[model samples]
Target: MSEIQEEAVLEQDQIIVESGRPKMLGYVFGFFAVTLLGYFLVNRYYMPAPAVNTAPAVRFAPSELLNDLNKRLAYLQNRTTGVSFYIHTIRKKENLWKLASKRHYSVHAIIGCNPQFETYDVSIGQKIIIPSRAGTLHPVQKNDSWQKIASRYKTTLPELVKYNNTALDIGYGDLVFVPDRRPDMALMNDKLREKYELRALFVSPLGGRLSSTFGRRKHPVTGQYKLHGGIDIAVKTGTWVGAAADGVVTLASDGVGHYGKAVFVDHQDGYVTHYGHLSKILVRPGQKVKARQLIARSGSTGRSTGPHLHFTIKKNDVSKDPLKFIW
Candidate 1:
């Protein structure tokens, strides 16, 4: 060999000698001959390997864990979040807490979803979002307590306090969030608005002119003095009946008598109103009714010849002339 080739070979031998590692190696048939032989023998049934005592892996899905947590913590979450309806959009690098603060939601609610983070620092494309009410504020009223506020907004008091930081203040007029109650309130509000083109304050069920006054009149059927408890409207027989106020219908009976088909609505204000001697009763007992909801078609039935509603206003269970309450 030449002198350079001889020197290169000598250097390689020296490195192998000092490091004792095979950096430049041909194909190695077995890394460890003894272990390889033993493994081969066991697989071929020459020798049986010792059994390994290993526990089965615990298997669970992230969604299942979240579901379990949600099921157990539903009440707590509800207490913090309240009933709501919202519109939300996902944005970059926004965290649940920050989004919640900006749009107003519970941090606990944000954590409930268990959002994902791509990097230690939030990324530009990272998405964080939540569902909540938008631009709806409850106008504060005098003597409004937390419970009253909650009732007005259709939310629990605890949720109002938590979401709006209301518990921090014991004084009156503390700002509180009105949870946009999911499912019903929004639609109901739409219905109310659609039905009443004018503002809700002026459209009273008793707003019509008192066409026919109540009490002793020359009876169209009987010429005798009979106690006329209900007022008669001068409208036609097909005139629609309206609810006097927000109430639950206690009874809707059609049995023919002095009071033929009758409707009794129990207003929560410790009073009830009765529409008697009608041809039709549309509502059933125990049905919750909104103000101005259609309850019956007016017609003359039983102990009457004219088509008019024998409307009576009862306060504290005592029947009073309907004219005193209605217009």
Candidate 2:
């Protein structure tokens, strides 16, 4: 009975061990499969895809691109280095030509820095900024563009931008340097141009009350309306009258035409001055006279009503208002 029972138990044990071995092997294989699948899924989600081998349509060589970059850097440096500025105080006998000659700069450069000057004439004690290089300092206005500025100055846009060492964008009131350019006097403001022209005229010969203005008026002697060629300034007989400008006396005669005891002076430049109704003549024909020099005496002359001096200025033989020249 013992042997039979032992044999049956041993057989059952062997079967159970074999069956458990297969189950354990399956579990290990399943665990490894699941881990391998998870690894693959994670790689697909996180890792970058391989790059395609497509060529670009346009390609620059490395050397060429590098050279271009270096050139740009050098140009930027040169543009920055070219700019410099300093201020100067004007002195007597120092004109723009002299100042520009000293610095090897142009008159335009000086005028560009001093936008406040209405005329080419510079006064003593005037403060002006001088640029190291020749250029115009153009003030940027509203809606101003590099193209517009360049066109106005008759320069290229790239050159203008390069001269300024700035971007194409310029804000209002910004001063942009235009290289090798001058201020366009014709483009100057009307008031400023007028002021410039007015300064070019001769100073008044002498200060006196303006009894009559220039233009068409009722004739004092004829009592008829007509354009008076000259202006009548009332003065006592023998009152000293001076030359209005530097000139050569063309004529000094008594009772000439309507101008009684008149003296005519030729100031060149198509300008001529007439002094009529003189009590005495202090100058002779073909005699050179300076401005403010005593040339004649005032008196009733040239069809006048009372003691007065008749003065006239002619440009190219055209009569102009005396007040415009003397006042």
Per-model C-alpha RMSD? 25.0, 31.3
Top-TM-score candidate index: 2
Q: Global lDDT for candidate 1? A: 0.54
- Tell me the spans in candidate 1 whose CA falls farther than 4 Å from its real position: 1-211
Give the TM-score (vs. native) of candidate 2. Answer: 0.43
How does model 1 score by TM-score? 0.36
Candidate number achieving the greatest lDDT relative to the actual structure: 2
Q: Each candidate's lDDT (Cα)? A: 0.54, 0.70
Q: Write the per-residue lDDT of candidate 2 for residues 1-327, one digit (tens) a residue.
A: 599999999988787677898876887799999999987765434322222223322223323322343332332233332566666778998977678878887666776656666656678987666678888667666898766787788876556544554432356655567788876656455654675465356756555556787889988778999898877777778889988888999999997978889999998689998888888898899999998899988888667778888888899999988755553
lDDT of 1 by residue, 25-80 (tens): 42143446667898766444332222232433222343332234333233223322
lDDT assessment of candidate 2? 0.70
